[model samples]
Target: MTHQVTIRNTGHRFPAQDGSTILQSALDAGLVLPYGCRDGACGSCKGKLVDGRIDYGRYSEKALTAQERAQGYALFCQAKPLSDVAIEAREVRKAGDIQVRKLPARVQKLERAADDAMIVYLKLPANERLMYLPGQYIDILLKDGTRRSFSMANAPHDDEFVQLHVRHVPGGAFTDHVFQTMKERDILRLEGPFGTFFLRDESDKPIVLVASGTGFAPIKALIEAAFKKGVKRPMRLYWGARRPKDLYLNGLAERWVAEHSGFEYVPVISDALPEDNWSGRTGFVHRAVMDDLSDLSGHQVYACGVPIMVDSARRDFIQNCRLPENEFFADSFTTAADKAR
Candidate 1:
């Protein structure tokens, strides 16, 4: 059984399949409804149920309090329509729609994902939550007023711990500390939810996600968010690293490919040694995309990584592959070295 869902302000209507949450069904129908943490932990998906009944699914009390429920507010991420329903929700069309915040987070855990990469998990204060779009980054404030920026690796839905994939730079101050001394329970001040490098939900075009090294962090967030939102658009991810081990989360990406129908993952290694025994695609990551997708005029690309890869992909895709200039979105991971140059 399928029921129709109507947006009160937008007048857009889509069918909610039986047992599917309204948010999931809306996304499947290509609607860009406002949402964060599809797991019912964040109230960003909270909206007024204008009409019709719904089975309010599992959600944290803090997210949808009993008082809010009495007032007709439902966490759309967890609400399944029992009949034709009309809901009031503000669609997030731009980064400006969400607020930027400054908060303190405790380093709950730190584990090395690779020889040069550390996966850092941050826990925000219990009474606070950072509302951010997938693919946005946060800045860690240093005592000297310098800031180190890192993308949030975890999707908004998995916000119990804000995750960051930090690559250690040999002589860099912040990263050296992260590699040498950063420990669990260390408190750090951070500001943001910054950057416009998020998904343009309004577009229904197939997506090409490119990442290099730790740039995979935000890309990971975007992919997880898409899965939770029920986005069915075809997506192919190109993750490039110098060696197989540098593709630290290779297993996780492979799992996504095995589990999802319209998703594909290609791991490219540029400088694999004989010991690495690499059998997969070789060469530059962006070039691999170009070789396979000669025609990208109808596609959208989200790229993150070092400046060279991001710049090359943006230029080549638009010039050679006929991809539209506006369709290219990127965030270049610039280090102190790059800035010096």
Candidate 2:
């Protein structure tokens, strides 16, 4: 059976097959919905169930609490319609314009960015190009039928090769191989250009970019894209790590500050040792943002990081900082361990 889903805000309607997720159905019908970590680990797809019933499929409690479910909110990425439904969600435009494809790529280079991070560069077929928004991610298909996701660190204009900053997750099948054995010229399969973490170029508000660890992958792409397009809006970046050595691209970020008059960079360390002689900001990365900007109501925040950081930022910014909830965009980096939990 098929149920009709009505977008109450836009009056758009789509047909969803039984057991099919609302997000998949919307995409199937050529409509785009804001989403991240489609596995239901991120709440980016959460919206009001204006009417009707849904399975409210398996999801992380952090993504959708019981209270939120009771209030008629659903994670469209995991929600399956039990009947015709009406939902109030923001319609994303332009995302559906680029097609998602599976392509073969050759590992062109592997540079050790840090003790636990590897920077990978993959070259596509001679005539092929992946047209994607700055902050989208691609899934690396593994031989065991599982997939590992990583954001493209290179901007669209700098697409000669796809770049990914992969942090070594010890004991992880994919990351272990990437660190222990994967080498230059090896072939890998990839599919995607997924997520809704890109900048909302239409908004004129100043931008606040928050990132932690490898989450900087997509943020790096976003900043380069903005610069390529000559976006003049004031931008501030807050990047956090456990120690000074973990800030792998510190020099690059510093160079961006030196070159761009409208851009500023802040590096925060949470667990610095005395021998490291750290003098920069110390504490949670998001907390650093909250401390510096008492008022985020007039700014648009784009955050990418571990679920905890992303979730905390989303909650505190809206509640205490008076930020408009709709202005916050995020892509939560859910690891395999996170998914298992």
Candidate 3:
């Protein structure tokens, strides 16, 4: 049986089948959606149910606690509609452009950007192209029915191949393989071009781009795509790391600043080792943004990083800096452990 799911604000409609997840239905029907972990782990796909009931699949209490579920909050990745439904969420675009396909990809090259992060470039079929927005991600299907999600570090038009920034998580199943046993030219399954955290071309408001650790991957993609499209809006980037080495692409970002007149870069270090002798912007990177922009009422923010950092920054940006709820876009990279937690 099929029920219609109507998206509020945008009025976009999708189908919800009795046995399928809401997010799966949206994608199947060629509707763009906001989502992260396809599993019940990350809360990025949480949507408010305006008018319907759903049987929810297993989910982390942290993502959607029992109390929140009772209050009409549902995780789209885990929820199945029982009847016609209405929801409120940002309308998806290219994510709606075409149906997603599960394709085999060959690893073209792998380069280490930092001690913990690797930039893997993959070559897709010559005739097939992945049309995705700037800030989306893909899940590499593993051999054991598991997947590793990594943000696309390169934007759409530059697609001779897809680039992913994979941060090595100690003791992680997939990451251990990536760092230790994975080899170039190995065939892997890739399904994606997911997430709604992309540049809103409709808004020319000043942009605040923030990142911590490898979350900088998608932010870098967004920035490159923005610059390539000649998006001349004022942009300020605040990137934080523990030591100077953690800011892997500091030189590249500095060069970007020199070339891009409308862009600014702020590398923030929270714990600089004495050997580094680093005296730049220090402490929480998000705080650095607060220090500069006392009023964010007129700005749009794009943040990618750990959930705690993204959550904390979002709270402070809205409550203290006067930013609107809708003006902020984020993609929280939850660790595999965080996912299991």
Candidate 4:
């Protein structure tokens, strides 16, 4: 059965085939919807369901809470319409024409950024170049039908190689291989350039960037892209980690601060041992932003990190810090354990 899906805001219409997700169907019809981690783990694709019923496919509880579902919200990436429906969702005009392809990549280099994090550089075929926004990510397709997603750490202008920061997850098959057994020059299949966490170029608002652990990957790309484009907007970055050493790319951020006129970097450490001699900002990274900028009404915030940090920042910034809800863009790094929950 085919159902007509209407966008209440734009009055655009598309056809949703039986068993097809709303996001997939929209893409098939050449309409773009803001989305990330199409597996129903990230809440980026969430939207208001104005009318009609849906299957409400399997999803992480954190992404779509019972309270949110009760409020008529659904994760379009996983929801399948039961009949013709109308919904309220933001269409991503910038990402509409970018194509998603499955291509082969060769491991060019592997640099150990930290004890638990590895920076892998992938080189695509000589004839192929992936055209993607700064904050997009690629999914490595495994032979066992599993996939691991990682954001590109390099900016679009630096497209000679795709850089990914992979954190070692204990007992994770992919990370285990990457840290222990993977060798240079190995071939891997990948698909993507996914996510809607890029900069809103049209907006001239000051930018606040928050990152935790490997979440810095996409933020790095975004900042570099902004710099490459000569975006003069003021930007501040707050990066958090359990220990100072876990902030693998700290030096690079420092370099950016030294080079960029309107850029600032703050390193926040939590759980730092006494012997480590830590003396910088300490506590949750998001709190540092709140402490410095009490009023974020005129700022655009970009956050990427674990679910706890992203969720807290989203709620606190909008409710307490006077930030507009639409100005807060985020990419939550959900793990296998997160999705299982």
lDDT of 3 by residue, 121-169 (tens): 9999889898788898888888888777888989888999898888888
Taking the tens digit of each residue's C-alpha lDDT, what string does model 1 give over 44-140? 5779999999999987775678999999999998999999999998764523445667899999999999999999999999978888889988999
Residue 230, candidate 4: how far off, in angstroms? 0.2
- Model 3: lDDT of residue 238: 92
lDDT against the true structure, each candidate: 0.88, 0.93, 0.86, 0.94
- TM-score for candidate 1, residues paired by index: 0.72
Q: Which has the higher TM-score value, candidate number 3 or candidate number 4?
A: 4
- C-alpha root-mean-square deviation, each candidate: 15.0, 1.2, 1.8, 1.1
Instruction: Point out where model 1 deviates above 4 Å.
Output: 1-97
Give the distance in Å from residue 62's predicted Cα in candidate 1 to where it truly belongs. 47
TM per prediction: 0.72, 0.97, 0.94, 0.98
Task: Tell me the lDDT of candidate 4.
Answer: 0.94
lDDT of 3 at 142: 85
Per-residue alpha-carbon lDDT of candidate 2 for residues 30-143, written as tens digits (9 for 90 to 100): 888999888887788999999999999888887888999999999999999999999999998844578999999999999999998899999999999998999999999998
**Candidate 4 Cα deviation (angstroms), residue 199:** 0.6
The alpha-carbon lDDT assigned to residue 13 of candidate 3 equals 89
Query: Which scores greater on TM-score, model 1 or model 4?
Result: 4
Model 2 is weakest, by summed lDDT over 10 consecutive residues, at 332-341
Give lDDT for model 3.
0.86
**Between candidates 2 and 3, which one is better according to TM-score?**
2
